[model samples]
Target: MKIACSIHACSLSCSNLQHGGQRLLSFPLSKQRLDQSNLRTMPKRKLSQSKILGCSRNPQSAVGAPRAKNLKTGQAEEKGIGKFRFWTDARRFKGSEEKCIVQKALYEAGGVRIGGYPKASPIPGPLGFQRPEDWDFLWAPARLALKALPARPGQLVSACPGMMSLTRKRQLSMTLKGSLGEDLAFSIIPRTFSLPDELEAFKKYLEKQRSAKQVKNGSAAEEEAAGRCKELAVGNSAAASDRNDLWILKTAQHLGKGLKLVTADEAVREAAKRRLKSKKAKPYVQAQQYVANPLLIQDRKFGIRVWVLVTGLNPYRVYLHCNGLVLFSTHQYSSETWRTEEGEVALGHVTNYAQNMDGMVWDLKMLEDHLGKDAFDTLWCRIARNTAMVFSSALPQITLAHEALSVQPESTFELLGLDYLVDDQLHPWLLEVNGTPSLAVEHEDLKVEAIISKQKNEMVSDMVKTLNLASRFEPRYTSLRLAATKTKSLAAISIEGSEVEEGRSEHTAVNVMSDAADGQTTSSDPQEDEEADIAGVVQNSSMDVSTDGEVSGAAVASKNSTRQHEIRDAAEHNFTEESALHVVSGGSSKTVQTVISPADRIDHLRRQLREEMAPTTDKVVWFRVRQELQQLGGFQPLMPMFPMKSKSDQNVSGHNMPWKDRDNELVSMLGKTARLNKRAAIAAEKKP
Candidate 1:
């Protein structure tokens, strides 16, 4: 059958991109208008607008609905988002009635929530601006991550981890942040005022990523800058300042967060007012220079959301998580086109999940694979370090400026939501820092929310482990203390052997005494008069306690002390060195003893799990390709955990492709035998 090459082409999707751009590119908007056959002939008279989101709507039924409901549904422009809540640091208004204000159901149509709450809000505060304080504010995740790490300088004595002496956590955090930002500028970031030649040089990255197929997911960040997308130049001197302020406004109305960007045209203003239902519409900011060319992915602009956890304040530490969401614009990238429209084409620039739900790519692997693993990994590391440096540079000033925001560095931690955009050179530019970055993903689609939630939970779980919150709940310090006590008992057993052999016992006594000097102790050996003398000498000084002919009792005692200390240390080390130990579940309750390193034990258990989880050899014929994945123990892809019905029904609830359509492959995964069997029986029943 011959397929029609019109705008309303049937049965075509993003996968059809391989077919060639001619059929899919020009008529992309045709799919939205296909359902509005009624308004085609009477385009202007009918005044019909398709929903910004891809949801189908009944025009006739919706005519009876309230206008406000329709706007809330976002059928006229972008899909309407649910009630939004905003938090303000009320302490800024300490003298006034408002200490901290939690405004519920915030409408993000306007560019600034600057003075909306508490009747009359206070002037610029730490939270209002994406100030350095905001970036360094949340310390909990960082604190937890620090605690979780196996290696450390020493015990964290003060509130802040690795605090040498308690004095100024705030000042330290601020100073570190400032220094980090500067370091990034020197090492990774291109100078903001780099000449035109340098600017053009960086643009080469745009082509690189395009060739690599690294980006191309739909993009838009809902509230990166008050619900609008902002172009943040490395230096404030760039002419992008005006355009930055303007486009951020366009995101609200054009992208569907709040309202559309209003132009000076009186007719356009009147038309927008009809949708807003306000007497006089909010005036648009004065237009200046348009943000220059933006790097695009497959003819589409892109953006990313970065997260940073400041683990400590005293010495200022930062944790940049390895994974982040890459968003793409729905409309193809055309700086030429968006520039003419006065920043109204949010679909071409913004990349918020709500704005582009189908475009969200959670896994970092896709990008890494596209950009060449090494290149991508290197760029990724640079981005993470840059993030740390940005806030670190600002930390000192931030802490000094906000004295009221003080907290016990250890007791509190802050997580910053950093938004970013990459230029042609692949150099990432920091857009804005959100102190209260929303851990929440509020969306009409449950699947979108679930995906975002899972993504967030993964990061949170990592942060928890990094902070070592598990150790906090576990009785680790107590165990270590007890082990210290047991250390002395070990000395007693070794000291008895000292009596049987003077040379050996004397050597051990000297070692023991040396250890006792360091605060660890061993029981006094009553039988060896020489050991007592040796112990005293070893404890007193580092000088040798033995003479050429006769061994000093002080030196002998020190040797015993050292031997005892070694035994206790070994016992303690054995308890903590779990890298070689593996505990297997046995059929019986009997305790089994096996000597193995933690690594070997882990490998053994993993091997067992792989075997247990592995599909039977008889049934493995169907999944020969995924056999390696089953055998390997790291991250593995599986079918959607949702019901099979939901997996097939993307419109109802499920992940985007290829995350959505892995059921057949999932049937062969480990621990999926029951599901495979159930599906097999169903298939057999339908075979007749």
Candidate 2:
């Protein structure tokens, strides 16, 4: 047997040399010629095949010849046909190179490779060297291969470089394909571009196209055009109509004197025109010219003016700035009215002093003066009518002025500020009349700044407005009269106790005299007489009596007369002691006895002497005689009623002379003697 080898001189040598032995296989003679010829003519194919098989052929040698190599002992056998190929033993492809070709093609075209011992040959791990051409070998399992790569920007770019090129749209489309080949191709292209500008342009173009299309659709387009046209027409129409109406109204107003166009509607205008024409047809009267009184207009009644007392120069400027009334002195007075031009008025001859005083004072004075005498009189009367003088220390000048006005006969009077300057002697001078006096003195000590002046001005103004002068003065006179009546009534009711007591004594004397005149008899005994006299004196002293027995009028007159007489008598006697005694006796006694002729006086004296002597001598003499007899008899003396009757005589007269019986017998004897003596006296007088 024999086999040809491409090495230098090698040949198959497996022949048995017997009739039954198999011959060693040899390259066909024709196949060898065809290969030799085709190899020379197709050098590129052969070189490609050589590269595929992971072997190189010498460019100068014939196709079937193998390149020389150093033969080392125990060199490892080549594993596969290509750079990334490996050996695999399988029953299906025993000793068949075609099977290897098929396997390499499938692996290169992204197919799985299957083979060999232990069941399958180990595929290259991810770290194993890979041929650039064998990248598709991993395509079937590239997802897993790619996952195994480090997740870095460069690695990702290497794995799927085309991803950077695929546009956002293309990438999305490719992603939808779900095919690894297209996805890989799509991901591999570079995507560098001006992305932002391109996108903006693209969007604008798209929008433009859409808008163009929308414009072509005439229903919406025509409607929009019509709407715009209608808006413009309406605006123009409204403007023209407004202008026309305004022009018409202005023209109508111009043509019709003092006429106003009140309505926009033509119908209303026509109606108004008709009414105006009708009104114009009627008669017209000229308006009267108004001539205001100069004095009245100049007068400042009820007007409030504010004054700022400034210390600086150009006070008038400040006043002018403040809108104040100003006063200025001038040499001449003007008689012309407001219509005529006249110079300043002389200060000295200013009839209204109020006009001369500037600022708030001027304002007040002008107000009062302008009202004139009659009006001011009315105003003052109204103010004073019910006003009571309110005495308050807070406003001394006002209170004093009020007091003075109250005492005055005129019910209305002007208020004045009397300033006192003590020039050696203290006397108040009439500084000025304050027709509109300030009621507030509370802020007198404040600084004279603009603010304080303004405040004071405002306070005074407010006071003027709030004050009801008419209401304040109405009831003063009535109240004063009532007060006076009360004082007089009190004085009239007051009385003294001594005067009342004297009146009572005089009344008692009268009572006693009256009782005596009534003929009421009393006992003549000496003790009874003394008791009566004491009673009369006590009653006279304690009782008040009038001579005429009346409490008023005639009784008082009689009493006064008696007192006058006593006084006269005392005066005539030069108040001698005896005359004083006589006067005193006249006041006490009811009657006085007078001395007449001697015989008559003698008899009266004899009777009075006998009456006095008998009571004393008889009582003493009888007590002594009774005591002598009582010692002889050792018996008590009998009581006697008759002055000289003895107890024994009383017994002989058959009187029994029981001591009580003796008293009865003596009483009877005294009665008989008194009768006998009266009878003897009567008889004696008859004989004479």
Candidate 3:
């Protein structure tokens, strides 16, 4: 059922477009020639002369030179260049717009030589085209119609399986509440109940509220009759009696389509009637507590549109766009106004850009300017924490879905649009998760359109960099492939032992240097000398060593080095006693029982993956990708808060960071994985 087609580069309509008077190069695109596996083995061919260098042409340059051109500047760039292809099933997107945007993005960020979907001739039966697996990258709708284009291993996908569970209103509400417990879920998101299914529970909630109200009113009346109530307190009692009874009813199937506010009593009555009259028991609507006291600007309510990229599951890797859009409602907001029909006409409560033609929006920087620096920082911290928690809660289901699909976790990624409504307390409440948030903007205002376009472009570019879709930067993919194909699988093997050895090597080198400085000869072990020589070379590359044989560098690095030497010396000295390390002791000599912190465990894992398993590890790949992202003029990472800690725990050891807000679940999962991998690696290393 899988068809593989070869798309020739010469067939592209835009192939001859003028690029700074120098024509952009196009490869054969023949599957055998362009496929990554065959790229190195393919026969070399001469490249034609460019218009820019028409005076002289060198056929030899075509064989070894990088010829990929930048999509924006049309200049030949040597950095991160590779031959990659992209395809789009634009049925669900804005057809031509989706194709154009993706094609350009793939050429620029993907490092694809020629970016375009293969044109179908007057042919039948899949148009004699390639299967989804053939393409380097795919852009499909959020529906995830796998049957139409079955998900295959090795192919990069736009959507993740089982994403609808988080995207749908009822499912998301039920999942979050079930996984995180009602208390935490209700605090993060509004208390939500799926209709029909949770009708009895809703009724009980209403009944409890009514009973409490009746008791309060009766007590007040009794106090008044007994002459215990003061005349001035009557107004205060009446004011206190008013409750937040407003609830929003949203269609489970559609978002921003049929949203309306209803009172608790009215909702209960409707639920009761639906339970009695309905033949089917399917959940059609969800009742959520409306956020009446929303954080507003210019007296208008707004909701933040967060763009989150989920690149992994289990220990999920999330990168949040720090500069997400802040969508503002066109009309001024007031809880009292929403109660009237005229207020509903003004659409003062809704902040969805699609619903309002003249919607006002601001990127995070603009919002930061509106709110002072200190206030913005505080607000952003909470938002980041809440967003991480939401994903952590959904980790179980996402993992199951990923397993069911039988695809590599690294091969799949999902871009989610997480909306949040901030209360007056600046606490952001989760609104809804979008599996395939739209990138296209249809705003009439040119300024708004320009802002959205810039943000979208930057986000998409960063996503490309993060995923490493380009062939040359395929370390993550290559490591995974090697692990998959090996008979003795090296999957998830920890390199902690290597790291521990490295530390010891550094300690030995420092000792040797100190002894030499004191005019003393140290041990003449070849390994020790080799390590010391390597360390000296690295240090000398950055800065000069002192004339008196003293090491000198930046104050911070010098201080950290001193701390490392002290810790290493102490660990060695203290753990030498057999009784102190009796549990891990084996064979003749007592073993050193140094605590492998979470950071050390992760570092070991990354190193082991690179040295033992493949040339580069996922961590190394992510680190490089992060560097690319930081250089961009857009959002920054929000998860994996302390990436540098994995390299050296000393980097963030003394900061008073909010430890309570850390993703403990992810950290725990990583630690467990590292331990298991370490055991496996040690066993393998011991094999004769």
Candidate 4:
């Protein structure tokens, strides 16, 4: 009954119970209960319980078995009551077969549970089911406890293995939780807060950046600069245009203003009027007509009509004409006055007096006579003894001008053309100065006015005054006549000499002799001799001589012959001597014989000897002797007796003569012995 109770309870409570059901059903009573009760019955009998319950027997063929009654009823039950027969031969039973059967029964009962048994395993549940005290001591306390443990080497003490394992699990869980909380605060919280803060910070940063860029670009200053450049360009262009117009206006104004005017003709006319007025105001002199007197006009077919242009009129003409007196005075006067028909004249004269008198002595003498020597010396002294000063001052300008003007064949006052009438005492009297002293025959065109304008009349007057020739003068005819006589005598002598030289037919023999003798006399004078010799040689072939004193031809021939013989003798002697020496010297004998004769040979030899023995020869002999002596001293003698050759035996004897002195005795003995031996040999040969 307990088995039936256990099975029924297990089947009812243990709806998921499997093995326990089989354990309970393995009891025999449990099988019977299972067969009887509907609560724990299976739809088919399991083979495991069939043997235990013996449900496979045939109930009809059984013999004599008692049947049981139902405990709750009084009737007897059949043996196979409430039972179905199973074919057990057809099935095999396993160990888990009964549990499988109970599982199926419980599953069919709709998840019922057995009241007295646990369903899960024997292991404890998770810490969540443990007490709270266990909560701290489990995973959480283990992590804290591990942190307090001493760390192993190469390990981090802070790392908890428990938390690491939990973190791994959470990571695994997060992998499965994908896309679940992405839009929630857990994923986007930081991004949400930082975005707004960043935006506000960015706005402030942008403001700072823009301010810095404005400082760098300088745009406000650039705009101001552009405005100023535009203003300057406009101002410059306008000023340039205004300046261009100003130049044009200034040019037009300049053209409108004309130049100051002038006329050349008006200036010339004014100058002419001034000149005319000046001429009208000046004093005038009447022109005087100069008349020619009858005597002058008759004697000279052409008479000069002279006009005297005087600076002042004279009380007496003689005083004005005192140039004649002052120029010819006997006294040594410094100043003198004389009266003339037209004027009274005062004159001054200067004289150059020089003691040297080398040059211009005649001029000095002439001047001395005009002003006496004492007065000349006085004037020269007053002028610092200067000749040029006295002459240049005392001589009039016209006189010097005339001296400067007179060209070829230079003139003095005496050669000048002037008319002065001679008085009864033969003294010349001056008339008016006539400048146009005409050489022309035509009276009408005498050029008198031109001559007066040139002031040549003043030159004539000054020249007359300088010469002092207006006074008495004498001609030098006697000196001229003496000169003429001397010239004539010289001419006659030249003609005579020329005639003689020409061999004129008119000459006598005595004259020729005289002339030839004169040549000798002329030759005595050295100067005459030189001239005559040159003349004689130049006219040698042209001369013809006829002398009274002459020599005979025979005598002349004899004299010439004697001269020739003397010359020939001297030449023969000189040539023969030269030829002999030349032959002896081993020169050409034929050439010597052709030049000299044998008759003169001795004379020639004598001459050659004399030449050789002269002082010139002495130098040669000394040189040769010294050389021979040097050779003799330097080397052995080639021969014993000086090696001389002789032309004759007498020369050998003469050679011995030099060696006879004691100093030459050895040589003399050798020479004598050699000669004696030679003589003996010659005598012996003659004896045969």
Candidate 5:
């Protein structure tokens, strides 16, 4: 049986009673909202691997050349923003599989979101990592997507496992190693969360005067030379991203939520003490890259909670979820703002949703009312770029980690929460990435968390349907489920581990896709019911197969815009020669030099799903999103692409950015030919 519980928002009984230690801060328990329904949980799990043997390539850089006079993003006299254009599918097949394509493999970074008795064998730790059930979860920021993503349905596959390790998030390979290395495969994954020592070292790197003289050797210099960031700071004019200094000062760090702000001089000693109190023997409060002059909500500080789904590494496949929550601070923001007698800025200064739920708004309704659609979107794109940067930095480490552990590509996935804070100038600063973000929706603001929880449920549900984890995914043959099993019905199981209606029609399954839905399915025809178990014999080409499993008329012509996972191209997708890889799976994922004949992969997908879909073309119809994307709000369904490319492929033709990112760029690129460009120019000239 499935249960859906809603919690009413309760006022907090929290106060900054103490500074550090377990008494750092305390909250009296509000009445629990769950009764027969106490706490609700979003069902999810994961799988993933990495590559390091020259296999990890740098993240694909944004294609647009830096505009000379683009909108300034930094707090200081507005440094130039790296306004990149969007990238089109390098190659999309002209006549593709939009017909037999069941759905995109839409998973959150990587994991299984369906809750219950795990259908697969249990791993020692969460997602195969060495984490204990009662493991001390260090505090971290929860991130959410600031942009809309392409969404579809199959079964369930999530990107960020509830517990995340940037190492797993940035893996660069999908292939498993075959030979046993001389000793063992050496693995090293980079840390997404920083320790006190790393923070100190980073600070030194930022303070140029000492950075150049800190007795740093060639290796240190080389490490610094690798990709990183521009400058930024809390002081509106100070360089935030470029600097080595931390703008945040915590009197102590042991206090997870009880963290106190400190000055530069007191930071080092307090951090040391905080590290000592760490159960894992590490510092929990490291210097956060300061977001100066942050964009505020109703004069109160806030942060965005975005979710990113990463399916594989090497060819890093990323899916940014469209819907997310905007959290606000309790107190109004002001540079001159501080507490009584003490120069401390409490929750108001920080945008943590958990910290400042009192009187804070949920919908970005406040921000939108203030900045309007154009400004908010531009800010979101900047956040997306910063997010990509974070992944790019960790790519190499993740690749190596995967190689060392011999992780299989399709076997693992991760769902990560990406937190971001945009400055007043609309410049976004990276906060911290959380490994396991709380999926429970019973925080102080119950009403808001409940809404967010519901959205998450829907997002995960669609994702499950697309991945076929509910019915088809077999843990043993993880990667080639489609290739391994030609005839099997996942309809027997749902993500929540509930029994699915044994003989339901494909159309019947859609209505009951929710966790609360009883897995009951119905069919109009009895003959079709008998054939459900026997996957219609898959021929070399789906175009040749009819609804009754016989040869049909010529295949319907498909449009070229169908999009699939960045790393995975399965189910309903048309892969051009560039996208399809020839695989010879015999206990190994060996990608042959040549491409897999399109007929084989696409046909295989058709055969497996034949039992699950309707004969009508509606089974593979596209969804439209121009306002709020239950998936990208403004995206056309035909364009399976996010960050859609420019229709005119001119050198000067700017890449079509996700709607928000494209607003300003649209004017810059198409302004000349656009009739509205003159009005835009006049408006620009009018600005002082």
Candidate 6:
């Protein structure tokens, strides 16, 4: 499509070497337009101006609408979205886990949800809708459909692209192993060896353990070694339990489906070999070291399921839900629990919520109350620290994986369920990270179900608020925090004559139509010196193109051009405060500037002051995000836990406390900004 443009040239010149003559010249808009003998006329369809410009007549009907109308002029203009239209595939979410929460939040926020159940959202797949890009967001468990059609800009996705590196069992083990080599602070993950791939490594580890045991028993290593071993051994039972060499064999995929607790004996090793050699078997297994001394609650094994929300990947933005489930085993806890036969049960050891249907589940607050404030506080610190370290270490892997896709970090958000088990020493051990956590609350008691349901609702609501899904689209909205620091304000420019510098002119004529309509050079002959000079002057002018392709800038002339030119602002341009005629004399040190019928600069300043008195776009957004986080309805920030110095020395700055000093440049800046805002608020309150 060709845009109708009119270029008002302040100066024009042409030179022909062959003809030996100088003449006034102009270039056609396009070669194609000039060459075409027949032009196709646009169909005459009588439509409202609002409909033609893609604006809604009624503001209330503009929910989840893309374009917003100008408040003052009533013209439709492209704007940043206030609310997003989401599409969810029920097939992607298992049994209404994610679908329920997503639809509920979308309904509450006045956003539309497209393509309801039996099938997934038809926007992303191959046989999809006509305009898949119309939907602003997509919610699904897997990125299979997204891979078929890459997400376009202005579209958000509920899942991160490369999260499989952290979610998959084998990938996560390998990622953390390479990233956190000697960082013992994050050594909460147990010693794990992937079967079939790391079979030799697993054998070597077992051999080393046996050799160390033999050396401890027979050889006279040292008196100090003996004393340390004696000190480590609290009792004979504890020493025996440590020497048992217990391991859990589990599949890499699925939750609590094929868990088997077994002692690493000759029989077990031979059985593993048989399974690997078998023609029918192709199991992805992980031989993980079992936690022998688990911190039991009411003589039952338990594990904490934490909800971690990650808003970005490159520069990590992580949050933790304050309330989570403490899942308990149905049977009594025992280190000796193991499956004897092929179908024998081991419910006493595994604390999987799915497997233990009749198991007890308590909220974080309940556990905190049970353990008392001080002990729970200490335990919470460990959990938060370990969680931060894991993500910090895994950031590179996740980011690298995401690089293969077209997903934008700003448009992707993920909610991960990280499972952690506490040892007898109150140290939290990392179990696994779930990309698709279950939100189903299944219990016989109505009271427990209600409590869990309320928590999930609050979490979803807080997430929506933090994402700023309810912000209205303002076409003329200016972020003063960014604009003030980045560009000179129009109000600050003097309407009276300002002195021109030696090399720079105060006022120059800029061809707005030529620059904005199309970015092309206009010269009929390249060899002509005068024509080349004219093209150079027009090409070098600075411009700032907004998202909607609107250009805003002051015209700049050539430093060597001597001829003066009069530039007029477009009559339709609403922001034109005044028009100036520039007079540049040949080889002069300064140019004579003339301002004609200038508008009230004081009024512009007053408008800016009034806007600044209220919160700016950036300030309002920052405060809204901070407020949602600080409310702590059901969520808490994991990295910036205390907003002070970290107990561990790994923190990059005092502001982002407890977060490991890795990929923390953006995090530090945010923390500092928050602190400055807090100080400003305190100072404002104390004013007389």
Alpha carbon deviation, residue 91, candidate 4 (Å):
99
Residue 279 accuracy (lDDT) in model 3? 36
Pairs of residues at least 3 apart in sequence or in different chains that clash in candidate 3: 5-130
lDDT of 1 by residue, 393-425 (tens): 454343442234333323334555666667766
Question: Across residues 166-237, which tens digit of lDDT does each residue of candidate 6 receive?
Answer: 788876777666655534423768887766678787787777776777677776466336435633432223
CA lDDT for candidate 6: 0.50
Choose the strongest candidate by TM-score. Answer: 6
Tens-place lDDT per residue, model 4, 1-688, is 1111122222211111123111111111112222223312433323222221222211111112224344556565443211100111001112222222222222222211111111121321111111111110111122232322222111111112212211121121121122123232112111110112133432444356445555777675764454345333322232321211110000001111211111112112222232222422321111111111212111221111212111100000000111111112112222111112222111111111111111111222343474577864553332221111111121222223323433111111111122222222222222112221221111122353233323333333432232222110101111111222223333454465655323322222333354366451111122222212211111001101111223255654564454334323432332222222222223545333222222222233222222222212333223222222222211111123231224445442114212212214323444665799899999999996
Q: Which whole-number lDDT from 0 to 100 does residue 348 have in model 3?
A: 76
Weakest 10 consecutive residues of candidate 2 by summed lDDT: 311-320
Model 3, residue 394: distance off in Å is 0.7
For model 2, what is the C-alpha lDDT against the true structure? 0.24
Off by over 4 Å in 4: 1-396, 399-476, 498-688
Which regions of candidate 3 are displaced past 4 Å?
1-82, 94-102, 110-130, 145-153, 219-243, 253-255, 272-283, 339-346, 472-688
Error of 2 at 629 (Å): 99
Clashes of 4: 19
Q: Give residue 397's lDDT in candidate 1 (0 to 100).
A: 47
Query: Which is the leading candidate under lDDT?
Result: 3
Reference-based lDDT, residue 527, model 1: 21
User: After aligning candidate 1 to the native by TM-score, how far in Å is the CA of 144 from where it should be?
Assistant: 20
RMSD of each: 28.8, 76.1, 18.2, 91.9, 22.1, 16.2
lDDT computed for candidate 5: 0.34
Question: What is each predicted model's overall lDDT from 0 to 1?
Answer: 0.35, 0.24, 0.51, 0.23, 0.34, 0.50
